[model samples]
Target chain A: MSFIQTLKQSVGLSTDGLTKRKTVTFGDTTAVGNGRFWSIISVITLSMAWYLGSALELVNPIFWPAPSAVWDQFINISQDGYRNFTLWEHVWASLYRILVGFALGCLIGIPLGFAMGLSEIIRGWFDPIVEFFRPIPPLAFIPLVIIWSGIGERSKILLLFFAALWIMVIAARAGVGSVKLSKIHAAYSLGATKRQILMHVILPNSLPEIFTGMRVAMGICWGTVVAAELVAAESGIGFMIMAASKFLATDIVILGVIVVGVIGYAIDILMRKLEDKLIPWKGKA
Target chain B: MSDLVVNDVSMVFDTPSGEQVHALENVSFSLKQGELLSILGPSGCGKSTLLNIIAGFLAPTDGTVELASTEIHGPGSDRGMVFQQGALFEWLSVAENIGFGLTMKGTPKDEIKKTVDHLLETVGLHDFGEKAIYELSGGMQQRVALARCLANDPDVILMDEPLGALDALTREKMQGLVLKLWKETGKTIILITHSVEEALFLGERLFVMAPRPGRIKKEYSLPFAEAGVTKDPRDVKADPDFGAKREEILNMIWEMEEEIMGQAEE
Candidate 1:
């Protein structure tokens, strides 16, 4: 057996069992009867373990807040507000920044990527600058962005924008580049003009890759927005967390972190649903 | 005048190692209206290169291809080509794929639908019109490809090893379909194949090509394709004359392979 098969067998995973595990972990909606049940059970188990650990006082409450304490902090923030902004205001502010940054990245990156994929000259022009910025961590640019654009909302949004732009461009370029040559030949033989081939053949074929790029960009945008808020922000979930940390309100900090995680997960799920609806022929093609 | 004429076509490729590779040299042929011609050769014999040149996907280093006395410049609706595999757009439905050519010409939506439906029936894919390209089997996909090419009503249909990727049984079935379509439409067809049997079965006129500065080594006018239209392909193949011709062609190709092997060893 190969290493992967041997490892799976050693872990008591038969081929059928591995398939079932995949269905459960990846949320295969068609297999939801069993998968949904298992997913709920797993989540409940984790929450129980966390609650029990806190109740048993295994860690100091100052650093590791109990579930009830976090819940209380959540209720308190919702009712009394935090740092002059209500709970909804903090979430809305963060969402607004992410939307602006991600939308800008997509609008610019998709067209630029297509231009580069279609022409060697355009690729040469943009490739160097894109390559230079792609690998640099979004947080690393915070100092430069603040210096250049100031510590206003512009700097924070710009950080998030830069994070998403390169990923979208690379994905779109790869999508266009990988279209089969035979497909193009077939279209040409059928009397399709250059414009028609671009609109019909290239565009639909590249959509799945572009959608994947959008999802990745959204994730990156969320991370950069939070990190930007942590550095300097007047409102947002990141600001709430940073402010709570300063006052040693560990419960509030934990609540803020949980909220961020939950919101990010929700967004990811929504994107996946949209992908299924819009690009139903993705893997089938 | 012939329906299509290819005169003194030659193709040369400049290798990265500063060598000039002669892909095709002094190749010429003509096809009458409604005639079916097959080019048979081994790999590297430039049969495919010649087909590409005729399809207007490549410009020959010298010479020209003329249709009805008009010089061919590039790919156009006058000539349709069916590729071996991976030609169909996987995202489109079978009907949409067949109607693609019509859509490009701005055919009315209802006319496209009517024509696509007619093609779907012709290809025996009546129930598969709404199905995605990826859902069809290999033979079915090739059938769709043929129907797609036919939808444009081109004067000439170029098939480059269209059945090369199919299994033996499916290949046989597809051969019957090709012959049926050829008889029904009466369009000029130029098929390229490495299969000696396929070449004999499909071509009314055959060009046997050789490699190493690829050129036509011999030509044959065969009755198998005409007989196949009326009689069973198997019975046609089983004829004494067919058997003799098959043996002769097979021996010629075997000798060519041996010569290639000897050159490689030297």
Candidate 2:
């Protein structure tokens, strides 16, 4: 069985114990109640299939290392350092770069977006530049960043900051643009000054969009950081995976991939939890 | 006493096609302090346009609106507006939305809370004070809208199809609430609606407007609104005079719609 299936079963997750047969009814397909159970089952099933397929030597071991071997590699990396740096050190390096880059992007981009959204002159001035850079992937700038700042943390962080900047700017602008005219008029009629309206109505209304942008930017930053590290970095999950792949260390590569995926997934989950707590009225209105 | 006077207000819009369309023409009317006026017409009627002009959201090409002898240049604390829907702040609780006006005017915190609490009770939404606006039903949201407007205690309250989104039963209940609020608060109100029954029931002075180059076609001083305050709205709607006026205005608007359709076909 695939390591994931074994992991699932080990964690006390199995649908086979439920006595009632789940009849897949039409129209209830989108219903969320039993869907979560099915999702877990699907993951468990995939892991089992991978495990069986590998044990039977159905696929080349070079491409798909056996789950147990990958697990062993994970345990090996946990004890012995990968390339002079521990797994946590690599994870911390990647996370530090992402945090600093994402923070810089949010700090500068949101206010710029607000300004562009609020003023026609500012929008006109910046729209061309934002639109020009937005579609250009963050990875495309790695070479330029490396050339300018050298293949160091600055280059990697700068690339990630640029990757997050345009997304946040567009998001903040959209958030400001999303304020309904009736709401503004309502505020004005209630004797709110222009500043008060902007602070209370416009700012609060834009928050949901800002949160959505942040989630998207975080995901993009995660992907961009890995790609950037693969291109140059000497100490990161991406670098470790890249380094392992050169030596045909399939198990180490698989383990590194899993670690990166897990960290990215964890970050997203944390963001969603924070979003739910902070903006409880999101989409409810 | 605050009297809202619209002196020959006209609105002309220059369409992108380069044609200057007269949305309103010389739509003049006066509302005495504590009066309730309902402007009713067909779809293209500038009844909403007139209301917007009076609310200072839109400027008229000609004429001016004066409230309590002061000309309205823009939206101010003297006027409060209730939109049909989507006007209440979704991010805020029902109490916060209601108290928005007072908070904006920088009223003391305790005073805002006091006014919001009283209005919450007034609109029968006392228990929903802490509830987010989206949690409420359409009728309840409108109740919040009404309470929010009333919280400001403006000289003139403007409503644009405030109960148009509610179901028939809820609408009838809200109609009674409107009459009750009007009678109790004694604030001049201008309500715009296409519903003939709503116009007949809620208006102390009802104006039936014509569509093309919209102007007041007819005026009716009705007893239903004053009676609706003390009696069941069903009883008010059951009045012969109310029925006659409803039919008359419906026919007037129906013909206007037909005339517009004919023009479109031509």
TM-score of chain A of each: 0.84, 0.86
Overall lDDT per candidate, in order of appearance: 0.90, 0.90
Q: Report how closely model 2 matches the true complex, as a DockQ value.
A: 0.79
Every model's DockQ: 0.76, 0.79
Model 2 chain A: worst 10 consecutive residues (lDDT sum): A25-34
Identify the runs in model 1 with alpha carbons over 4 angstroms from their true place: A1-45
Candidate 2 Cα outliers beyond 4 Å, as residue runs:
A1-41, A52-63
Please state every model's RMSD to the true fold in angstroms.
Answer: 5.6, 4.2
Candidate 2 CAPRI-style tier: medium
For each candidate, report what fraction of the true interface contacts it reproduces: 0.82, 0.86
Model 1 chain A TM-score equals 0.84
Error of 2 at A269 (Å): 1.9
Model 1 C-alpha lDDT per residue in residues A60-177, reported as the tens digit of each score = 8998889999998889889889999878799989999999988888888988998899999999999999999999988899999999998778987888788888988998898899
